[model samples]
Target chain A: EAGVTQFPSHSVIEKGQTVTLRCDPISGHDNLYWYRRVMGKEIKFLLHFVKESKQDESGMPNNRFLAERTGGTYSTLKVQPAELEDSGVYFCASSREYDLGLSIGAGNTIYFGEGSWLTVV
Target chain B: DQQVKQNSPSLSVQEGRISILNCDYTNSMFDYFLWYKKYPAEGPTFLISISSIKDKNEDGRFTVFLNKSAKHLSLHIVPSQPGDSAVYFCAAGDYTDKLIFGTGTRLQVFP
Candidate 1:
């Protein structure tokens, strides 16, 4: 089975510009998520999508960031008027949603993509 | 504040020896923990995981130990190989299924 795949492995854009990152999750996976790692910081969750509906988006940084998954397929994260601080490695992950009470080990496992490196200058 | 933390920034181990990585979390609600290994230009891959109900879970050469009381967890790799050198991230999960990760520890294994 192919794992999650991200497009434009590396993106460099000027500050105040708009950039969009894309992610194609594994086939049949209902749970998709977005996360990012800034310099000297741990990877942090951005948002999650379950079949086109957002499950959680509390981690979003600000209003300039937007994520969408239409038809429960691929996902896109758009950053408008990007700032320098937004530069980081953005990762997309997917998992087969199972009962949370069943087995915590494998049931809730999430597979990650290679990540897209975005640099704002 | 960071909920999960891997205090050590890096660790060096000789091949054929054991490599132990440590992690501590501040949140008591975190019931599940996982370890991920990442290589340059690649994404993180799941190494092993352990639930709060159990103290230890072993998989071949990898093992994860969770101490609920201390809010600490660890990953142990036996007979470490050169290929095992990479950045290892410790993550904690709650009922929401969101994995909160640590800053990661870079492990280098020498032959």
Candidate 2:
């Protein structure tokens, strides 16, 4: 089975421009997550999706960012009016719904895709 | 406020030695902790994890130890190999599924 997959592995955009990054999670996986790592910063969660519904988006940096998961299949994160500070690697991850504090052993682990490196110049 | 922190930005170890990476978290509510390994041009991959209830968990050459009292966790790789070199991230979260990640520590395993 294919792990989570992301497109446009690398993107370059000017400030104030818009860029959309897409992620295709593993087949039958209901959980999808978006994360970003700024320069010299840790990877921060942006949002999460359970199927097509937005579960939690508290980590979204600002109003300029939007994430959507349509039909509970794939997801897209869009950043508009991108700024220099927005340049970083955007990662997408997926997993089955596992119980909290339970074993992350076989059949209950999260997988990540090759992140999309975005550069805002 | 950064909930999780990996103080060391990098670590180097020779093959056949032990590589230990430490992480500290400030949030006592975080009930789950995870470690991720990222290779160049790849997203961070699931490594090992331990629950707040457990003090230690091991898999193959990797072992994760959690100290609830100190809110600290460490990942140890025994007999480190060149393939073990990568950026390791520590993440903590609760049932909410919102994970707070620490700045990664790059591990260089020399042959």
Candidate 3:
């Protein structure tokens, strides 16, 4: 089976421009997640999706960033009016829903895509 | 505040030697810990994971030790090879699905 795949491996845009990064998860995976890593910082969670519904978006940085998973398949993260701070690597991951009784590490092993590198100049 | 931290930004090791990477976390609620490796221009790949229920877990040449009391964890690579060179990240998670990651530590193994 193919691992998670992302599009436009690298993107360069001017400040205030909008950029949309796409991710296609492994087949039959229902849980999708987005994370970002700024230079010299840790990878931070952005949001999660279970099928077509947004499960948790508490990690979203601001209102300018938007994420959507349509038809419960692929996901897209769009940043509008992008700032210098928004230039970073955006990673997309997916996993099968965990069984309530199983250990989190074992049941919810997430697979990541080759992140999309966004540079807002 | 950063919940997870990898103090050493980089490490160098000779091939056939042991390479140890350390991590510290502040959140006591984190029960699941994981280690990931990333090459240049690539996303992190899960290496190994350990649950709070155990103090150590090993696979092949890699071993992960978790010290719950100290809120510390370490990854050990035995007989380290040049291919082991990469950036290693430590991550923690509670009951929630989201993972809190640390700033990565770059490891370089030379022959």
How do the residues B1-111 of candidate 3 rate in per-residue lDDT, one tens digit apiece?
899999999999999999999999999988788899999989999898888888998989999999999999999999899999999999888666788999999999998
Task: Please report, as a residue range, the 10-residue window in candidate 3 chain A with the lowest summed lDDT.
Answer: A98-107
Q: On residues A8-71, what C-alpha lDDT tens digit does candidate 2 reach at each position?
A: 8999999999999999999998999999888857888989899999989999999999999989
Best candidate (score: lDDT):
1
Off by over 4 Å in 3: A99-101, A104-107
TM-score of chain B of each: 0.98, 0.98, 0.99
Maximum-DockQ candidate: 2
DockQ of 2: 0.71
Q: TM-score of the A chain in candidate 1?
A: 0.94
Candidate 2, after superposition: displacement of residue B103 in Å? Answer: 0.9
Candidate 1 Cα deviation (angstroms), residue A109: 0.7
**Residue B76 of model 1: what lDDT?**
96
Q: Docking quality tier of candidate 3?
A: medium
> What DockQ class does candidate 2 belong to?
medium
Better of 1 and 3 by TM-score: 1
> Local error of candidate 2 at A50, Å?
0.8
Q: Write the per-residue lDDT of candidate 1 for residues B3-88, one digit (tens) a residue.
A: 99999999999999999999999999887888999998788998888888889999999999988889899999998999999999
